[model samples]
Target chain A: MEDPLGKLMPSEVEFIAEDAPITITPNFQAGVFLFLKERVGPFKPQRPMEVPMWLAVSLRRRDKCVIHVPEWLSVDALTTKLEEEKMQQKQFVHMPAHFQEISSILFDVASQDVPNSEECRQLIQAIVDVRTAKIRQGGLDDMKDSLAIQLNNVTQMEITSIRQFACHAMDAFNRLSSV
Target chain B: MSYFDIDDILMQEERLPCVASIDVIKMGSLDPSSATPYLRKGSKVDLPLWLIKSYREKNGEDIFEVDPPKFLGPKYLDMLRADATVINLQSWCSHFFSFAITYLTLFQDGDLATTIQDSFGHRYLVILDISQNAVQDDTSEKTRNLDQLERQLFHAGLQDDRAQQQWRRRQAHRILPWAGAPRRDAFELGHLTKRPKLSFS
Candidate 1:
C-alpha cells in the first residue's frame, strides 16, 4: 500500500498535525457562517476570533479577514534565530518544517498585516541559501546517518529536488554497475 | 544483504523499456524498422528523451526540444518523501530514470558521473531504513511479490545480448574521440615541417 500523500517532509506532516490555531479580524459588518463537519461561525463583523491556520489563510486570501502573524514568525524573532543558525555547523536551528511554506503563504496572502514582511522574506532566503550550501558541501555524509534529513526552514519543493537528485544518482550507479 | 543493497535492488525495478516512448505517426515516411520514431515535418509532439537523443545522433539535427520530466523536480520529490507509502514510488522512479539515464548517457562527465554514482551508493543505506519503516507500516507480502515479479521481467528484457551490445556501442562511440571527430583528407600532412629558406647575405 503506497502512501501517496506521506511523502511530505516532517514540517508538512506537522502542519497537518497541528492544524494550528490563528487569530483573525473580519472586516465585514455582518456575521458569516462557515460550514465544515460542523457550522463554525456566525463570524461577527470586526470581531477578532481564533481559527485554524488553513481557515485563516483561506479567509485572508478571500480578503474577508486580517490574520495576525505568529510570534515565532515575527521579523525580530526570525532575525535573531537566523543569526544563531548561521553560526551553527551541522546543527539546524529550531523551526517548523513547513515554516518556509507557511511564511510564503502568509506573506503572499496577508503581507499588509505581517510586520516588516519584506525584511523577513530576505532573512529567510539568506538562511535557506546558507543551510543548503552547507548540506551540499557535506553531501551524503550528513544524510547517511539520518533516516529523514532535517530540512528545517527549507520548502517542500527543495526537499523534493534533493530526493530526485539522489534517485537519479542511484539509477546511474545501477546502470553503470550492471555493465 | 545490507540496507543499501536492498535499496539498489528496489531502485533498479524502476527502469522503463527503451522503446516505451515510440508512437505511430500517420503521415510520416518513417520506416517502421528504424530505431527512431517517425515525426512528420512541421508537426509537434512530445518525444521521449531517449528517442529524441537517438534521432539527434543519427540525423545530426537538434530539431527536438527536451522538456525534462516534472517528477525530477521538487514538488514530486517532496510529496514522495513526506508520505513515502502513499504514492506509486516505483512508477515515479521508473519515469524519472528513463529520462535521467538517457540524459546522463548523452551528457555526463567523468567526475560528475563518479560523484553521482558514489552518492547513490552512500545514501541508499539511509534511504533504505526510511523506506523499510514506511513499508512495514502498510505494504503486504502480495504486493511485494508482485513488485519482485515485475522487476524480474524488466531485468530479463535488459539482459538481451543484442540490446546490450547496441547500448554499449552507442556509449563507446560517444566516448571515442576518433568516432566523433571529423575525418582528415589523405593529402593533409600530419605534421608541419620548416621549409629551408636560402638567405643570401
Candidate 2:
C-alpha cells in the first residue's frame, strides 16, 4: 500500500493492524459534524483545506451560535457524565464548531474590529467562497475529508491573524488549537 | 495527607517502591464512538518509555515482559509516582481522574460488559468511538454501544487500587438517591441495624 504521507515512501511497511470501522451520529447544525460515520482509511489523495463547508450556514445562524460547556463531574464520574451526555443531544460545549471552524470564527470575530475590517471580511469571505465551490464540485459524500482539510487551512489562516487581532477570539483560537 | 491517602504506600519503599509498575494503560477520548477500535476486544496497550518519562523524571524500564510486575505499562506506574508528590488529595484525585480521562473508558451495561470482557479480558476495552453524529437519548443500540464504552471507563477506573478506593469513596457519597438509602450503605447499615442483639453471640 502507498504511504499516506506520500512524500517519501517509508523504508519499512510498518503495517498497523487496521482498526475496525467507526460509526458516528451526525449533527445537522454545526456544518462540521455532518458525517454519521467516520472510517480511518489512508488520508485522502488530495485533502481539502480547513475551511468549513457550512461556514455560510453557520454564519447565517451565528446569532444562535452559543457555547454551552457542561458542568465538570467527579473523576470517576466522567464516564458516567459522558454516558449521560451521550444520552442527550450532542451539545456544542466548546465553541459551537470543530477545532478548525472555531479558529476561523475567532479570526473573523477578531477582524470585526480591525482597520479596513470590511476588506478583511471580504478576504475571509473569499476563502469561504472557495471552500463552498469545492463542496459543490464534490457532493457532500465526497466532501467530508475535503471539508476537514479546508477547515484545517482556515484554522491555520486564523493562527496567522493572532498578531493582527489581539482579542478574546484570538486568545480562544490559540487555546483551542493548542488543545 | 490532603484528599487522597497515599501515605501508607509511600511509607513502604519496597511494597510501594519509589516507582511501582503499571499493568494496563489506555489513552485517548472517552466517547465510545471515539474509543471504539482501541477498546475493541478490550485490548490493553503498552505505553512507550519516552512517553512515560514525559510524565516523570526517573530511571525506568519496560517491564511488560516481567512476571509479578506492578502494571502493564509505565504510564499507570508514573501515575502512582505522581500520587506521592502531591500534598492534597484533591490534586491526587484529579491526577488519577486525568489518568482515567486519557487512559481508561467507561462501559455502561452489565450484560455488554460481560459479553465484551468474556471475549477479550483486558484487551477488548481499547475500541475508539469516532461517532460524528449527535448522541441520542433512546436506549437504542447506538446508546447502548456508547453506554457500554462508558461502563468500560468506569470499570477501568476501578482496575487499580487508587482508582478503586476513590470510586468506592465517591459512590459512598454520590449525589443521587434523594429519598432512599444507597444500596452499598444499606448493606453496611443492615449489619449495624442488628445492634443490641450482639450480646448472645
Candidate 3:
C-alpha cells in the first residue's frame, strides 16, 4: 500500500562499505525524537512537541530499501544478515531476505519523502511542533500515556528494539547531513 | 602516571556518592513547605550546582545553604542543559550545573547560554540524585538519567529557532523531493533474531 504521508526519501539511500565504520555526531533534536518513538512505538497519543527535521530525514531514508526476509526474524539475526550484506558489498550482491525486510521499514519511510511537496512539508512542520512541545513540556506523562498499552507488557527486548530504532534514526540523519 | 588515576578524582571521600554538599543540605533542617512556586510536588531533587551558585548569589549563600533549592522529582527526571552520558548519571546538580553555568558565565559565550535558555523552554529540570553515582556501575539504576540528559541537550543545541526553521522548514525540505516520510515501524524481536519454523497451523 502507498504511504499516505509520502514522507519517504528513497533516492537518498546509501550503500556504505560492509567494512565502513558507522560514526555519529551529536544531534540533540534528532536523538530525542528517536528516543521518543522507540519508547512508545507508533500510534501514540499526539504530543505537543516539535519534531526534529533530521529525524524526518532519517525516517525517509529508512523507507527506501525493501529488505525481504523469510519468517525467522530477530534483531541479532538481522544484524548478522546486515553484516553479511556489508561484507558482500564488494561484489554488490543482493542482501539477504531479512536485511530486505528491515530495509522495507526504511523504504516505507523513503516512499514518503516529498521535501518540496506541501503535504510533506506540512507534516514535517507538525512533527517539529510535536517535538518542540514535548521537549519543552516534558514527556514523562505523555510517555506513560503513549506506552500505557505496552507498559504492562513491556520487556527488555522491546526496550532494546526502541533503542535500536533510535540508533538507526540517529545514524541516518547524521549520514544525510554529511552528504 | 596512569590514565585511570584520573577516575580516582570521582572516588575521593569528598566526591564519593558524588554529592557531599547536597547530602549535607538534605539532612539539614530546610522546610520543604517553604519551597518556591516552581517546585514540583515530588521534585525535591537538588538544584544543579550552577543554579545553586546562581541562587546563592541571588538569594545569598546563607539562605540557600539552610536548605538546598534542588528541583523536585525522581532521579530519572533530573535533566540539565547538555547531553546526558554515563558520567551524568553520577553528577551532582551543583557540580554539573556549576560547571556548565560557570563556563557560560566566564566565557560570556552566547552558544552555551542560549543552549541553557533553550533547555529552560523545554521545562527540563536539573536535579541532584544521590542514588546515582558516576564512580561505579553497581547500582540497579545505571546511566538511567543519561537518557533524560541527552534529550535536554538536543533542545539546547537547537537554540536558533529561526535558523532551524529556515533550514528544516524552508530550505532543505523545499529543495529535496523526499524529505518528509512516514514514521518508521517499531522493531520486532523476530526481526532481530531467528526462530524455528512451526510445523502446522
Q: Top model by DockQ, which number?
A: 3
Q: Over the stretch A1-179, how does candidate 2's per-residue lDDT look in tens digits?
A: 11123211011110110111112222222322222133121222233223222332232244322211112212233334334433433221121112223323333433332344454434434443444333223322222222221222222222222111112212222222221
Clashes of 1: 18
Q: What lDDT score goes with residue A139 in model 2? A: 29
Q: Let me know the TM-score candidate 3 reaches against the reference structure.
A: 0.20
Estimate, for each residue in A1-179, the C-alpha lDDT of model 3 and write its tens digit: 11232322211222211111211222222222224223212222222232233333343344411222222233444345345434531222233322322333333343332222344333333433433333323322232123221122222212222232223223322322222
State which candidate, 1 or 3, has the greater TM-score.
1
True contacts kept of 2: 0.00
DockQ of candidate 2 relative to the true structure = 0.01
Error of 1 at A143 (Å): 5.7
- What lDDT score is found at residue B25 in candidate 2? 34
Worst 10 residues of 2 chain B by lDDT: B11-20
The list of candidate 3 runs beyond 4 A from truth reads: A1-116, A135-179, B1-201
**Regions more than 4 Å wrong, model 1:** A1-20, A29-39, A139-158, A170-179, B1-201
Residue-level error in angstroms, candidate 1, position A52: 3.1
Best by lDDT: 1
Candidate 3: tens digits of C-alpha lDDT, residues B25-78: 343323345344333223333443444444456743323332322321233224
